[model samples]
Target chain A: MGLKRNVGLMEALRYQGKGPMLTYILHRIGGLSIVIFVGLHILAGYLANHAWGANLGIFINSIYENWLFQVFIFFFALFHAINGLRIVILDLWPKLIEYQREAIWLEWFVFLPIYGIALFVIVRSGLGG
Target chain B: MKTKQRPAPLGGFNFDYIMWLFTRLSALAMYLIVIVALTGALLMSARQNMSIADLMRWAFMPNPNHVASTNIPDIEVWKTIFWQVMAILMLFFAGAHGLHGLLNVVEDYISSRRIRMSLRALVLVIWVAISLIGITVIVTS
Candidate 1:
């Protein structure tokens, strides 16, 4: 059997799988975000230390250091970590598959407070508070 | 008495299986490293001496150079081979796990076997370059 390749963007948008669908999309986005962030972070570190690339390194660091960027990175990192953990748990114990939705709710329950505190700190520091 | 039956192996030791396992193990490993680094930082008076940025850098990478610009008077403690190894481990695990995840996502959108192979090769090259550069920086600094 061949893979179905006919799903259009509009069709995708119109489909509503609700919470699972939302989490699925967000997880992918979160994963991609972390990959980009980590890549740039390592590159920046290398550049900052190298004589020829020091300025560029500093430039990249400065960009990510902006509170706005920090907020976005933190959000994705925390979400990815939490969501990944949930997936891992489900994989380890297939019996828990029945509670998948509850697991996601619990994920958010755990995610929000930690993220909230981090967000507050970031915003406060950003505002020079 | 009923005899216990051994389950057959599912597709023994393929690349996808290994990577699937690697993804999970690496996530756990990174968490462990980060926690250990965070604890070490707190012990080193991170809250009192380091800014949020410095603390974060140390937590994520734990390389001595990451804390070089911080207010900590003595960086000598951080300049050990142990932290160097920690940084290298972080670099490799994160690089492999993340790049593999990206490749998986890309592969989902690409149907052609040739295109998939090319993309895998590209991701491999990028991962190697990132790992090498990261290791060099961690070691030399």
Candidate 2:
């Protein structure tokens, strides 16, 4: 028997292995989110930069200034950036591949706090601080 | 019927292997560009207390603030060129790299070969379109 057939949501959610797939899934999500964000960013940025697009620019700006959107965007960007750096480092030095588990730990431990602080400043300033 | 065995690499060069390599390279470059863009954005926003609309206007237009302060005629020109070039490069590499990675994810998750191929085609088309728009904007700017 090869690939398992037709696993539903609950079945997929139930882990059957020793190693967790959280990071794997996160990496995929991060990549997908960033791509979508980048597309919207380009469209909005272009519109905002246009001569006759002030109203649309304002509309997009209002959305961008939302605290929740900022947090998600920041988190997505940070996660993708840090994890990408890890992958790059490992690829260049395959010997360090063995430390991938640690790399993921370092990614969260070191970067998350940094991002959190940055988020605090951004949100504060964003909200008329 | 679903194919049981993993498909071989696309060609002699190994499409998956090459894409794997390219993804890392492009991702590293993309990360650097994002850092630069983000830092610039944050600084500009904080300095001017700028809304997104204001930021966009300031970015694409000649910087009236800088002109008022520095009285530098070509500074805005250079800044525009720099950001435009950066945007183009970021879009090109990011589009390729992100779509490639997403295609890999599609392959992993989609069991039906037909659907996988179709999704990959869609990703490729969108990526190319976005990249072209990015380049066109930069060129026009």
Candidate 3:
């Protein structure tokens, strides 16, 4: 508590802005989504491995060979991507001492374009008609 | 009595407790997935022979018939278990980079919205890529 009194206006604002708070929340969401994704990943790979005496691997390789699934893959991937970048940005910046809260909000702004480009490229390739 | 040693940077009892809890929860979910799948395979083991289509259909669309006439419970188990193990493994890659960044942020010495956004975006890419590959593997398989 004693250390807090010396905090400047910006420091105080940043603290109130909840960088740590948001991180904690995002961490949980990211963690859960990852788990869902992981579960699916293993099942797919196991099947693809042609395990249980089948060549399911071949089917998986060509999954994006269709349109709908390719799009499904795109959005799931995009959500995870945008959220992930936010977590990273929150951590790497050394200026959390002052503009940290501002930075947290800024994450949303930066995320949009990146998400769009990534989605476009992935969709085009995955759905390459 | 011996003096208490200094706590490790993040090694308090509370931290250890949480880690244990997380491991146990994750482990339990995984164990159940495997057990169910195996039991289903057991019923199918009798008239033994499988193919890629057999595996694909089994994984994506769970049913007693898909498992080669296995019991419904077994196929049901396989339904959720399918693809999870692979995703967990993929997580190892991101875990190395993402978790480290998370901790670094926690211990940040500076705070800037622009910088936060930048790093967040980077990790977002990682998250997206990993998941994309994961989905591609699961639904397609």
Candidate 4:
């Protein structure tokens, strides 16, 4: 609502300049990452299962088989979903914006252990044995 | 150079307020959908010992494994219908949420109102186009 605080490309991309700045950057990145994966998932799933072009089924299957890619997806999803809850809470209670730092710390505290467990599960499953 | 101020609020609200409300609502909806969808996949995958690929195949196609394994005779038919509906809904909401985020980014960096508006329009067009294509894939598959 204020006069535009237009920034240069360098400033725009300089998320590492501050703590909250980094969170903002990562939130956008996390959301965008999931969106990208959604597109890929839809297209690949359609190709693999559809009547006209089941030929590409193996190619799509290979992507799911790739452990590295799967890990990346899991992390993106974890960060996005957790942070999104924080955003929703903050939106509902603007007074808690001051506690943003504590919220993020809690988010990371929860994120690390759960992500570790997810990786363990993936590996234990023999990366989809 | 003089700084331009935003026009007075219309009916005690402004564009920023509307956007704020819109973003919050959409974000919450998108988050809930993602959580339900992912949780279902993870639980089912673990129960079935299914790989992601196998899960995808099983979800979209009328696979025998799922059919024979399910308790309810009509569960597969219900599930296929549910998934198809969810898939399209996810595509639309996710696409809108993503484009709105990107639009805010463009607004942050682009000083000119005209340029920002143009970019937002472009983003919306792209989002709609992609959603249409994705919906088509979901329905016809």
Per-residue lDDT of candidate 2, residues B27-65 (tens digit):
777667756765665554434554543443343322233
> Taking the candidates in order, what DockQ does each have?
0.28, 0.36, 0.03, 0.36
Interface RMSD of predicted model 2: 4.5
- The CA lDDT at A56 in model 2 is 86
lDDT of 4 by residue, B1-141 (tens): 233444343554777677767777877776666556556655544345555444533443322333343433344343466667776676666677777777778865565678878998998887877788677765655
Per-residue accuracy of model 4 over A1-129 as CA lDDT, tens digit each: 555444556766764667566667778777777666666665665566666767675476577667887788777777877787888898799999999989988988988998898788777776565
Please give, for residues B67-131, the per-residue lDDT of candidate 1 as tens digits: 88888988888878888888889888889989999998977776566787999899999999999
Estimate the lDDT of model 4: 0.66
Candidate 3 local lDDT, B1-141, one digit each (tens): 122222234545785455434443433343344345444444554225554335433433233334544433334444454445533443444443444344345334234446656776765665666556545554443
DockQ of 2: 0.36
Number of colliding residue pairs in model 1: 0
- List the pairs of residues colliding in candidate 1: none
TM-score of 3: 0.34
Q: lDDT (0-100) at residue A97 of candidate 1?
A: 96
Tell me how far the alpha carbon of residue B93 in candidate 4 is from the true structure, in angstroms, after superposition.
2.1
* Winner of 2 and 4 under lDDT: 2
Which candidate do you rate higher for TM-score, 2 or 4?
Answer: 2
| Model 2: residues with Cα > 4 Å off, grouped in runs | A1-8, A16-20, A48-58, B1-12, B32-83
